[model samples]
Target: MLQVGPDLVCIELKGVNAYLWTGPGGPTLIDTGMPGSWSQLVGDLAAHGVKPGDLKRIIVTHADFDHIGCLKALKAQSPALVACHTVEAVYVRGEKSKPANPSVLGYVVHPLMAGFQRRYDLGVWQLDELVVEGHVFPEGFTALHTPGHSPGHMSLLHKQAGILITGDALSNHKGKLSLPMVLATPNMGMAVESIRKLGGLTYETACFGHGPPIVGGASQAIAAFAQTL
Candidate 1:
């Protein structure tokens, strides 16, 4: 676990990133890493003096397995309320087969990728809340509905801290900001447009779902990346 800011902590599990923020009531979790990562996640939280049941809320950016793999397990352990976009609530509730349609390449590769296809029985748990653009939560975080990677993908912004928890709307691999892989993103065009929207936001730090955090000048970096689209 890495503390990227005063109250922001990042837990990276096998390249997937989840975040912890010291909110007004308790620590708020951004995403739950891949399956089998529950122990590590709990341990990291403990390291920061946050024990089980101390987590007050869990905000899932999307319905991707990699992003919400540990949701059921985590929520079972803690009474944290789970919030996700309304569009993704169906998939989270197991009412839909998929969160979004996959691209041509994704269709060919998804079946072969066991990790992506793994089932976690998350359907048994119902989402406690549905978030949308402009929705505010504890710690002054606001949900930004930036879809394309997934129809309900969201990027969170802590306006006061200038921090953006970019779910899968944007990726920062090796400090490089770019769109997520096209194969996994069924609507690449919409994803690009989302990036443009993010570029307009004012933020200094960026926390990605798949890479290390960008600590400074994050808005400028995203703006520069948007120009290439």
Candidate 2:
């Protein structure tokens, strides 16, 4: 786990990542890592002296299997309320599959993943809140409705902490900032648009789902990347 900002910790779960923020409101978890990642999630929380039942909230960035994988188990173990964008709630509740990509890859890849997607649906989970755009939490994160990776994907910004959690709205995979994988994103154009939206935000440190945190001048780096797009 890496100290992100103030009380925030970036917990690396195998390949994916989750975050733990211990604040005045108690513990808040952002994302839950890949399915069956419960053990690792638990270990990370324990490192911070937190338990599953101690979590105050679980903010979901999107409904992909990897991101919400341990959500079901974690929620069951804790009283933590689950919050996600309204559009993403459908998929989180096992109501609908992630929309297909608008690219040629989606034409082939989505079809093949149909069976796996259904089998992997970690849903039918209950949502305690809807965190739409401009919504602010006591923990200080403002929800940014930056859709692209998924229709309801939302990155979070803790203005007070100067930290931005880019939940696959874009990636810093291999320490390089870039748009989310094209095949995984339904609309590449919309994804680019989302990056532009993030560029408008002010943040000093940026953390991602797949890479190390960019600790300084993160927003400037993002703005530079946005210009490239």
Candidate 3:
């Protein structure tokens, strides 16, 4: 785990990353990592002095299996309120078998990706809160709706820290920023628009769901990438 900001630790699970924020209210988790990652997540939190019971809430950026794979297990242990965008709530609750918006390639590759799908044990779960664009959490992070990768994908912005937690809306591969794969990202046009939208934000650090974080000059990097779109 890496402490990206004051009381904000980035927990890496395999290649995916989850974040832990400690505040006066306790700890809040952002994304839950892939399946079979629950034990390590709990251990990491404990190492940071946050007990499982100390978790106050779990914020899901989207309904991707990798993002929410351990959600059910974590919630069973912590009972933290699971919050996500209204559009994504359906997938979290198992009302939909897959993300509402999947790239055209996803439709073609989904069948062949059964082994990958089997890694996640998705099921129905109650959402404690519905988040929307501009909604601010108690921890001071504001929700920014950046769909395309998924119909209700969201990125979080912590203005004071100049940090943006990009939940698959953007990714960092080998220190370079890029969009999620088109095969997995159903709506490329909207995804491109979302990338342009992110460029409008002010941030110096960006934490991606995949790859290492860019701790400085994040906004400039985003703008430069936007021009290529």
Among all candidates shown, the one with the greatest TM-score = 2
Candidate 1 lDDT over 74-140, as tens digits, reads 8778888889888878766666645333656677765544235445665535688898899998668
Instruction: Provide TM-scores for the models.
Output: 0.93, 0.96, 0.93
The best candidate in terms of lDDT: 2
Model 2 C-alpha lDDT per residue in residues 1-229, reported as the tens digit of each score: 8987778899988778899999766599999998878898999899999999999999999988778889888888999989998888897887777878877778678766555656766884679998789999878888999898899999999998899999998888777888888777887788899999889889999989888899999999999999999
Candidate 2 segments exceeding 4 Å error: none
Report residue 211 deviation for candidate 3 (angstroms): 0.8
Residue-wise lDDT of candidate 3 within 118-217, one digit each (tens)? Answer: 4465643788989899999888889999988888888999888789999999898997888887677767788899999988889998889998888889
Which ranges of candidate 1 are over 4 A from the true structure? 99-103, 110-118
Query: For model 1, what is the error of residue 106's alpha carbon versus the real structure, in angstroms, after optimal superposition?
Result: 2.6
Estimate the lDDT of model 2.
0.87
Question: What is the descending TM-score order?
Answer: 2, 1, 3
Candidate models: Cα lDDT each: 0.83, 0.87, 0.83
